[model samples]
Target: MTILIPSYEPDQRLIGLIHKLKEVSGDPILIVDDGSGDDYRGIFDTAKNAGCTVLTHRTNQGKGRALKTGFDYVREHGIKDDIVCADSDGQHLPGDILKITEAIRRHRNHIVLGSRQFTGKVPLRSRIGNSATRMVYAMATGKPVQDTQTGLRGYSSEMLDWLCQVQGDRFEYEMNMLLEAPKAGYDLYEVPIETVYLDDNKSSHFRPLADSAKVYFPFLKFCASSGFAAVLDFALLFLLQWMFGSLFLSVIGARLCSSIFNYTVNRKIVFAGRAQTTARTSIPKYFSLAVAIVLLNYGLLHLFHVNVGIPLFGSKLITEISLFLLSFWVQLKLIFKSA
Candidate 1:
């Protein structure tokens, strides 16, 4: 396995992380120095002394650039079957590194996230930032991930080349990949891991609001389109129901009409030509997944409204939440899979 660590002016914390990883796994460790100044040469030297492969940038590119450099190195060297990405800030534990590797071995072709539970000594900024991004991920992909901001991720060898092709100069790269993964035939799984927030979680370079916007702005754009489609759907549904006296038919028709528009806009504008597959291959599979979601969604709506006496709107709202996990899995399989 190849362990890739992206570092920028890493201090003793990075050396400690490298040592721990070296002790735990014999996998080749590569440190991609993200344009840290000349002063950080000593740290890079320390990593080299510890048997890590060091790649340095002349100037500081962002984390995304460093990560891309690592991917390029691994691919160019033909190291297959053991790949993991960890931050140099010492937040993600070495034990979790082993677990992430194992998860990759099992999943084989999926993206594995070392998910952190939101508990204990959590920084307020991190809390708010992660919570907001997690919600954005949920809204865009219908998946609920507690740690959208986690830099501790594992990828199989097959994904290395795919990852190198992603185009983001900063933090948004990972966020974009998360959105594109399901659309590109990759599976995503979360491996539960312990999270340590040191120094009240202040040892990292994450700009709370700016980076949060960078990561989530894409999803917000999708949300805008979805919102407009929703308005159109509801208006059309109300008009049809008032004219025809069939609430069930009107509601279903409205949702379908809106969902189609939402999917098209999402595939086109939001995904922005990033997804490599055409609608010719994706549309039928997408429609199949949508059909299943409609059934599950309507069933939940019916159960909530008819059995529990919830209003139609309230029932639909609740059903959307309930179907989140199911929808996310199907979307990951059907939408992200290669044709």
Candidate 2:
């Protein structure tokens, strides 16, 4: 397994962390000094002498950008193995890192999370913030997640590429992984890891109010637009029923209206693209494929509600879970080529 560490002006804390890592395994370690000032040069040199590959940023970027830098370096180097990524802040234990690596070896297709037990006298903000974000991630992706903000995470080479592609430039970068994993056909797994908060947990860079907004706003925006689409769908269905006098036709019209609005909004806003032209061209194809999804929605709804006697409202809920995956797959593959 490969080890990646993203650091910012790392001090003796980082030096000690590297020593611990080297003792555990002989994997190639990449230390990304996120534009740490001249003060860290000696530390970097010391780490290099201690057998760790150091990658430097010209200036201090956010933690997410630093992680992207590390991932990009690994991809460019053509390393054909999975890697375990840990923060340089000395919170993660080397033994837990090994456990994460072992689990990754078993489940290469999964995005392994190092779930931290926040049982001790952790900071109030840190505890509440982690709990909130973890629940949001699980809800948004329709997958269960224990800890969304843990830095001791492991990913395969393919997952590395996926992480690099995620567009957040700050703390939201971790949240992006949870949002896009389902779209990219990867699942989440958790390995329980010990939590060690130093300095009474005052050593974190997380901005309580600002970063929390960044992390949760994406999901909130998604929900707000979905609410509007739901209203639009109902309006269209009502109008169509009044004009055409056919219930089935009205429901179909409503489905088309809502699906189109939903897909268009998600493509443009939720999964913003790098290639301008490709994104524009993918909209039509997205709808074309969505037609098949419409059929699926109807079939599942009918099977659960009519055939199996499930309540109509609850059936729609169950069917939407399937729709979420179906639409996500098509969007990643058919719409934006690089999800």
Winner by TM-score = 1
> How does each model score on TM-score?
0.70, 0.68
lDDT (10s digit) by residue, model 1, range 1-339: 888899888789999998888788888888999988889899999899989999999997788888999999888877775679999989889999999999988997788999999777788888887888887788667778878888989998888888998878678888878877886789789998997888886668777677666787765665577579879997989988998899998988887888789778867776555445678876787778778877888788889999999999999888886565454445444564334
Q: Could you tally the backbone clashes for each prediction?
A: 8, 0
Candidate 1: segments with Cα more than 4 A from true spot: 222-271, 274-339
lDDT (0 to 1) per candidate: 0.81, 0.81
Where is the poorest 10-residue window by lDDT in model 1? 330-339
| Stretches of candidate 2 exceeding 4 Å from the true structure | 222-339
Candidate 2 at 93: error in angstroms? 0.5
Q: How many backbone clashes does candidate 2 have?
A: 0
